[model samples]
Target: MTNVFEAQWEASQVEAMEALRAWAVAFAELNQQMSSWLDLPTTDANALGQVLWADSSGDPLSPARLGQRIGMTSGSVTVLVDRLEAAGLLARSREHSDRRRVTLRPTPAARERARAFLEESSAEIAAAVQGSSAAELATSTAFIRKMAAAASGATTRLRAARS
Candidate 1:
């Protein structure tokens, strides 16, 4: 039996979580459209994004690593890698100490195209936030970060449960 104020707070929390979920789905749809701009499906688009992120982070990319990042299976990753390689978007090598560990990279042209597309989207986002107060932006950023952490924890728990 919760008090009235506690119940109200819980309700508000639920509403905020729902809004977060909706925002995530909308963002994914936008990303899908961006992928279409590259003439690639959502899976490949996500995989490409992960590869680019790894590269930007100065971390090496590989098919196995990408599959883990994108919630894809080993076979699916292999085929996805094959298709991207065939499309001239992905470059593969074996420079790692472990000869069996294949490294992945995005082609310069593909990376450039993705960068251009995202720049346009980011400019739109910047414009959308133009009138927002600094405090508002900080609050929004904090909320998003908190929600992201919770969601990531949920994913790990669910994956472990499945295993």
Candidate 2:
């Protein structure tokens, strides 16, 4: 039964997939809630999140790069940035060498609010995973990293196929 299940049923794989789907839904809900709480459009909240993440990572993200990451058009990104800047959630600065090049900067107030929004979920996740051994956590990290890469490649292939 084990061999047949492994070969034909994909065994417990479907259960794992169901869990992953639920996790994905939870993440989407988090984004939706964050957007609502911020009184911002989902797209704008996503853009601000990207800017905050980049700034925290010590890498300044440009509008073009953020648009590319979020699959938004240049014109749409321009409009989004304008709206965010107007909302005091973000600021833009021109590159010293290339005055035409604009980079996103998250306001401290916005970053603090974003972190506050995420804190409860972060704490929950930490508590849930706290029982994992070092080796178990390492294995989970590797699995998730590989899954992310595979998912990214699948998205690229799907986009190309659509094109």
lDDT for every model? 0.86, 0.85
Best by TM-score: 2
**TM-score per candidate, in order?**
0.78, 0.82
How well does model 2 score by local distance difference test?
0.85
lDDT of 1 by residue, 11-68 (tens): 7788887888897898898878878988999899889888888988999688888988
Locate the minimum summed-lDDT window of 10 residues in model 1: 1-10
Candidate 2 matches the true fold with a TM-score of: 0.82
**Angstrom error at residue 74, model 2:** 1.8
| Per-residue C-alpha lDDT of model 2 across residues 119-153, encoded as one tens digit per residue | 75577778769978999899878977888898889
lDDT of 2 at 28: 81
How many pairs in model 1 have backbone atoms within 3 A of each other, for residues 3 or more apart or on separate chains, i.e. clashes? 0
